[model samples]
Every structure is written in C-alpha cells, then in structure tokens.
Target: MNLLQKPILFPLNEKVRLIQYITGENSMLEHIELSIYDIEPGGKVSYHEENFESCVVVLSGKVTVDVLNGKIYSQLGTRTSVFDKVPTHSVYIGKNRFYTITAETKTRILIAASKTDQSLPDNLIKPEDVLIESRGSYHNKRYVQTILSDQDTISDKLLVVEVYTEGGNFSSYPPHKHDQNLLPKESILEETYYHEINPTQGFVFQRVYSDNRLLDQTMSCSNQDVVLVPKGYHPVGVPDGYTSYYLNIMAGPIKVWRFHDDPEHEWIKDRL
Candidate 1:
C-alpha cells in the first residue's frame, strides 16, 4: 500500500476516463473517500451494499438517483456548469444501501463516501434547500453553500459544502483547523477539497500547516484537482482573473464541526 503525502493534489482529466476514484491504496485517507464521475447521456453507475454513507452531488447536467431499486428516487441537477455559480442538487444515501445513478445528459458528479454504521435516511437536497451565504469582508469574501450536515439535514458522518471564491479573494480565511478532539473547542475531522477553476485553465493556491510548522506545505492547484486535508490550518487563495469553486467533504469521529483558528490571524475576524 502506498500512502499519500499530507496535502495530496491531483489533476482530473475527464476526457480520458469516466470515473476517477480520487483516493485509493496510495492515499493516506482512512475514513473519507472521494471519486469524480463523468457520465454520458443515458449512462448509468450502480453500487451495492458497501457499508458506507455517501453523498452524490451533481456538478452539472441532469440525473436521476435511484436508491434501493427505485424505492427511493429523485431527479436532480440544473447548473449548466460549476462555473455558473448556481445552486445544484445532491442526494444522501445511508450505509448499507444499494443505489444507482442514471445520467439524462452529459453530467459530472462527485461521490464522497465515509465508512459508518449510523442509520440515517435516504434524502434529496434541492437547490432551494441549500443554505447559501457570503462570508468575510472586502477582498476576503466568498460564497458558501452548505449541502449536508447538522445545520441543514440529518446525517451520520458526512458533511458537505460548496464554496465559490471570486478572483483575487481568499477563502477558508484566517486559517482554521479541526484536527483535535477537544470537545467544545475542536473536533478531529478529515476533509477534502475538490476544485474547479472558472476558466478551466485557471488555478489556486492552498496552504496546510500545523502549529509548529511540522506539516507545512503550500500547493498550486488547477481545475478538476483535489486537495486532501488530513490536519492543520488550511487556507486558500485564488489568483486574480480566475474564480475558484471547490466542493468540501468532511467526516470524523464527531458529526459536529468545531474548529480553532490560527491565533496569529484570528484577529482578522474581529475586524470583519
């Protein structure tokens, strides 16, 4: 087995492959798993009992999600592309359930799964139900759409959110970390950022570091790339002229999200 580096980044080429499983034997991931699927019109993908909680987010085009052999099903999606910055659709399926996704058009979907035994319901999150909010001040401002979690829907261990940062803006600002299991202060969570740049050729920069700089690393990322955050304060910067979009998927021992910001930059929040 090959383990991935702390901040693993990889580009995705949709033209050569239909489905790319981002994390595998060569990755350091222990709980969270992710994959990107490029399905053609009328294409289908099936899954049996895998004993994992999963969320299928339609990045573009239309698709019908059939769970438990159509016992639970829904047609979701609308954004022509992720760069459109519009709210899209997603489906959450609980552990040990069979599911199938059928594309009605050329579609790109993100499948994020986490091993769990918690019993939750199979549900659909419509565009309207997605909580969209703008955070930060001036140049640091960015839009965030929460797809699943305690604040919106009920789930066992999966937490999903989509973030859109304008060109030259900062996201996950001030640097925050959820790497400790400190009850009310912070909770240990493993996260991944699936990125998509506006121009399809643009890029972004991300930093992951610990208190003592033991795991510090700054990485340049391009469209259809993924950044894995195992721990530490993570912050992102989008260069001028390119809007950045990333789908965040997180899961850990606790279902709640409690984080601690880098003390040095935490002051920035007071002025916001």
Candidate 2:
C-alpha cells in the first residue's frame, strides 16, 4: 500500500475529530494514535486508560486536569493560541490510568497515544520546562519545542514535539526519513503531523516520499489538518504571511529519533 495513503487529514468540525482513530484500525500503523478535542467553556471529558499511554497538550485556553479521580490535579495556565509564540502545557498519563479534563474557557487539545505496558506515574509538563530551539538557517530556519520526547521525559514508545515555521520558511528540511531501523544511522518510526495554521485560512504544503519513489505525495494542509508518515522522507513549507504550527507525534520500536537525510538534498546542509 502507498505510504501516503496512511495520512488522513480532517477539517475541523463542530464535534471532536479522531484522525488516528479513524485511520489506525485499518492502516499498517501499530504504535501511534491521535485525537483532537474542541471544547467550550465549562465542558468536561472523562478518560480511563485502556492499555495505552497518552499525552494531552493544551493547544489553547486554560484547563484543569484531574488524574486518578483527583488524586493528582493541576490547573494549567493558558496559551492564547498555538501561534502565540509561547511555550504550551501538557500532561502525560500512563497505561490503565484514569483522568478527567475540564475546560476553563474555549479550548482545543491534542491527545496522542501509544500502546505500552510500563506503569509510569502521570506528570505535568510546564511551559518553563519546554525546551525551545531554533534549527536550520535562512528560509529553512524554524523553532522546535520538545514536549514529551526523550530529551524532555522518558517514555516507553511515544515522542511528542511542536514546531513553528515562520511564514515562507521550511521545516523538517533537508528531506529526512526514519523508516529503516539501521541503528547508528536511522531508526524506523511512524509519525503524524497535526497542523494549525495561523490566521485560520492560511495553509502549508508537506511532501512525503520514499527513496525508491514508490510512495510520494505533496499535501496542501490547512488549520487542524493532519498528515501521517508511515514511512518516507517528509518536509514541510509555509507560504508567505502564514506561520505554521504542527504538533508532531511519533512512535516506533525504539524511543530515539534517528533519521537519514535524503542524500540528493543533503548538500543543502552546507549552505545552511
């Protein structure tokens, strides 16, 4: 099957959307899952872990997360929006856990999950702890914030991060792929990009392809759209006047991020 077919993008609607839930059950993916929640003020949702570990990222607005029936509770501060250029907040809950989320205001949240057997305690990731770094150079430069990855916290099979590509800039550049488990070189991983374009009507372009060219696709993505990378060299570009924010969720046999740049475009690194 074509790898591009793995990516399922959904336009935002009045109800919550489960891109992963709709695509995962029938796709080749076995590790990662994702869902989006659009809640109004005073709205609440309850959850009980069912053999998977999950990380809830508040894309916008304030929220109170109650875990273990309130045994561990926290009221997370708010971000005006993902495009606000500020660090966001998140909470990670382990397998078989129970939790509830109540919104203090209109909000949007992304919940990414991966099956695991490890029993780790639930924890909150504060804005102060989010590591923000600038990568690439010139038009390729973009900001990356590590949310739940190996560098931030240990996880059994989940890696979460967010990236901001300035208008007209590029991200996940130099065209890289992590579809082969060649340790010390590249590790196989399945990834998903949940995008939110600033201005709501703006859009971005993402290309996913394989070395042999057997699977290739260039997608025009807009707000709340999702793109999945089962295996390929994926890169994204934002148009002028439209900043792009994408929450990346990934999983694989290994917990580390090891990728190989497309040799044809590796030369671009010298110019950066």
Q: Identify the leading candidate in terms of lDDT.
A: 1
What is the TM-score of each predicted model, taking all chains together? 0.91, 0.91
Q: Against the true structure, candidate 2 has what lDDT?
A: 0.81
lDDT, candidate 2, 1-272, per-residue tens? 54333334353444333343423686667788787777677777677868888888898887888887435545675687887878888888888888888788777777888888788778788898788899999889899988877554556888999999989898999999999889888998899888888788998999999999988899888787778898999999999998899989998887878999999999999999
lDDT of 2 at 53: 89
In model 2, state the lDDT of residue 35: 74
Full-model lDDT for every candidate: 0.82, 0.81
- Candidate 1 lDDT tens digits, 21-134: 755454777778887877777777777647788889999988888887445555689788987888899988888888888888888888888888786788788898888899
In model 1, pairs of residues that clash are none
Q: How much does each candidate deviate from the true structure in C-alpha RMSD? A: 3.3, 2.9
